[model samples]
Target chain A: MKYPGGIKKQGSSSINYANRGMNFEADINVTNSYYINNDIAVIYKKPTPITINKVDYKSRVDAVITEAHFNTPSTTDYNGIYKGKYIDFEAKETKQNYFPLSNIHKHQIEHLNKIVRHGGIGFILVNFVKLNKIYLLEAEKLCSFIESNERKSIPIEYFENYGYLIKPKFNPRIDYLNIIDQIYYGGKL
Target chain B: MKYPGGIKKQGSSSINYANRGMNFEADINVTNSYYINNDIAVIYKKPTPITINKVDYKSRVDAVITEAHFNTPSTTDYNGIYKGKYIDFEAKETKQNYFPLSNIHKHQIEHLNKIVRHGGIGFILVNFVKLNKIYLLEAEKLCSFIESNERKSIPIEYFENYGYLIKPKFNPRIDYLNIIDQIYYGGKL
Candidate 1:
């Protein structure tokens, strides 16, 4: 199979999923690089956990993992320090008008909650890809919505009301720290 | 080859190095878990980066990585929130009297320096494994030493003068955070 730009795709649904996931993370990675290069903030995406099953040793100093499997992460995807404050978040993208709550795992939500309780900034960046809209919703607000409503998904209206819209840019791409400035520092930046 | 306690050696110096590294990190993990369980702090070691070379899919949802290699990390190992402050640090163990500065990469030192400049706490935990001595040396102190000294290795006298000794405990093992409290909070705790 071939994807756009003449890149051959391995015939696997998992590869497609992996590619899609990488796109979102790659955008954030570029944004983080811009921030780091500019001395603005130091944030990083945590690498995905891989469980090694087998390793082949070529020499005493050289070894290659021959088999491994992806493992679930216990924390959010991204976290770091911003202006001396602990900044933590998870980024997800959805094509639907309603964001499914199941898109986030229970442990991840708990981790976010704990961050907020520790006086660290915690939020979620939801990219409505079809709508070309990005929203930064506080972890507290998401938790409240989940606790109060019996709905399995959060409507677009809730995000519009409570979440801050992050405008995309050319160099930094997502410009999420702009939203952070508004939310945490009273738009000082 | 077989190691003691019925554990089989993986017949690779890299594996031996990995096992030795994991022993130090595992102790820190247990300590972090203790702090987390006690609501003292939330710290975690970032997962290692692995470059995936090939994947084998058995089903639509299942995929196994067939070939991969470990990649170098851009930042320090451990980071988290402690008492509403961002804490970042790297841990290194040495068997010699003089700790070699080459053990830390340039980029990692830059990362630690950035963390300090941004008003976040950053440090290095040096464990003299042979002597069973763990020292928590502040990032600024380490940077100044590196910048001022012409030598490639930091002598034990430097650590004795500038670094706080972290006493090992029964439950948490490496209680470096205790030194952190002493350094940062005027020993209030």
Candidate 2:
């Protein structure tokens, strides 16, 4: 399968989604990392940080990542660039709700708020593992739900009520950039 | 110590560079992650992408980062954003001769080339462990040496020739943001 914008040549690291054991996030990460490398549009998943208790630095300087628990709840899991516009997002996979705005952190919401105010594009790539469904909820809808959910729980129905479900595809796999092409750049994949 | 930009307050994680035994990259990572959560910036160490062979997702969700290995040589160590600007760089440390340009990858040079073409700020962070001196070398110059090093090797004299040495500091320790502030943001730190 050929992807425009020179995606087919993005190295095969992206083509194979390790469905054998990994869950939704790892799959999406491999896919996104593949896209960024191909220059399709620079996007990536932030590695779960590890605390380094010590380093041997045997030679070529490989500081092994030890078990370092996150000091705080994360804001968003992914951030990068598309075209020239900054791209930031969080990926959430839910079995029951698919996506209730409550899964997002408050500070993360605030971080996206900063992204939006700074003239950047922000959103979420929600995976409904049960439905095998994916949705690209724009930052605006996400923010609104977050603001309202503060007063009450945002039911999963609310998301299915108002969210852009991205049908998963092969070839470019997630092919998320296609959505960006239409929504942000005003075109079709 | 009060660091500018409400750092430690934004997240529970704080830079404990003293006890950290990891080489240069890990130190910067702890520091950079500290900076991001503080709302000072959003930076991440890009994970070395892997092609997974197996998975055992017992239930509908959740999987561990159990086993994986690099499918290819890495281009750079860390990259993310700061103040809405796309930030990219390679990190290296050496007890001798600062850090050799040869330690950097050719693909990384090409990658940074693309980053700069796209109107993003790109550079290399060099830590001289023996001398305890850090320098933010512009990608442009790094590329020059990388391209020419095929003839022989990058002489340390070159780095000793043109690199902005960054010293370790307390509040916001990595302080590359300060360099970014001066170079990309157009203000003094």
Candidate 3:
């Protein structure tokens, strides 16, 4: 059985919720790192938010966390500056044919809305594993979809219609920034 | 004895390192909340980075982390969009008359420099507890100091000369944004 990208794999030898969406996340991290190194952009994946409950001071510099729990993130998973523009986004993947709106939190959508309203770029990267396609859906477009339609999940057709397809490639892997450049900067890059 | 804003109080009932700089962090959190509520800007404190080891999934929704370790953050503590500009900064407080260079990690400085080079507004908020003063030191200015001088720490006088003093007040306690307005937008707000 194939697990979707975002779902946590249970009872695995490597039990890390940080690896919830390992493949997609790894792709994005590689892309962001490449962007930073090449001086094309300076984007970073915000660390997974976790609430610490107990810690043992093994040493001053080395503290071992004994208890903790992951908290729902208040903001997007990734954000940074690209071409002097504030960029923010959440990356997700699904084994299904459609991208589920439930994959994103309500407040995250609100946060993205606030970012866009304040003149920052905000979007979501949705990867359809079955279709072998990735799409960059702007927050504005996503919000309008939610408002116009009562669909809980965004169908592949909607993404094809409104979302910009990001072609996967070597080196940078997921070239979302190229799509951003095309849409926002008229392919200036 | 008054504990300075950034130092962690060790071994006195509470041991969560998240409280390493509680007073100053709380103040900033409150200030950022006020900004968001008032539609001023969209800034947020990135969560403390942690490397999760083991987890106990009591149920699907609730997962308890059994073992973990705090990771040194690669980027600054706070970042967001302010007035259609990318804003990034590390907030630190020093008990000494001089702010020590050791408080900030080396790579964080590099990260800030990259942000500034990319045309983002990058700065550091240094709170001097004894002096009862806070200063917003721009990344460019800080880099110049680091390059020109071999000084291990920045004297309060340097802050007085090179940094914009942030006057503490009610509501938005740390009014650093006001300083940004004065410097960046000529006090337009």
What TM-scores result for chain A when each predicted structure is judged separately against the true chain A? 0.85, 0.75, 0.87
Best candidate (score: DockQ): 3
Superposed Cα deviation of residue A46, candidate 3 (Å) = 0.5
Q: Candidates ranked by lDDT, best first?
A: 3, 1, 2
lDDT of 1 by residue, A1-189 (tens): 555467565543323332333377788998999999999999999888788999999887677899999878899999999898999999998889879998998889999999999989999999887776778999999999999999999999999999988765555777899988887788953
DockQ order of candidates, top first:
3, 1, 2
Residue A172 of model 3 has an lDDT of 83
Candidate 2: where are CA atoms >4 Å away? Answer: A1-34, A51-75, A101-111, A117-119, A129-132, A150-162, B1-38, B46-75, B105-110, B151-153, B160-162, B167-170
Pairs in clash, predicted candidate 3: none
Reference contact recovery of candidate 3: 0.94
- The per-model lDDT (C-alpha) reads 0.86, 0.64, 0.87
What ranges in model 3 sit over 4 Å off? Answer: A1-22, B1-22
Per-residue C-alpha lDDT of model 1 across residues B6-69, encoded as one tens digit per residue: 6565543323333333488788888999988988899999988778999999898788999998
Error of 1 at A166 (Å): 1.1
Worst 10 residues of 3 chain B by lDDT: B11-20
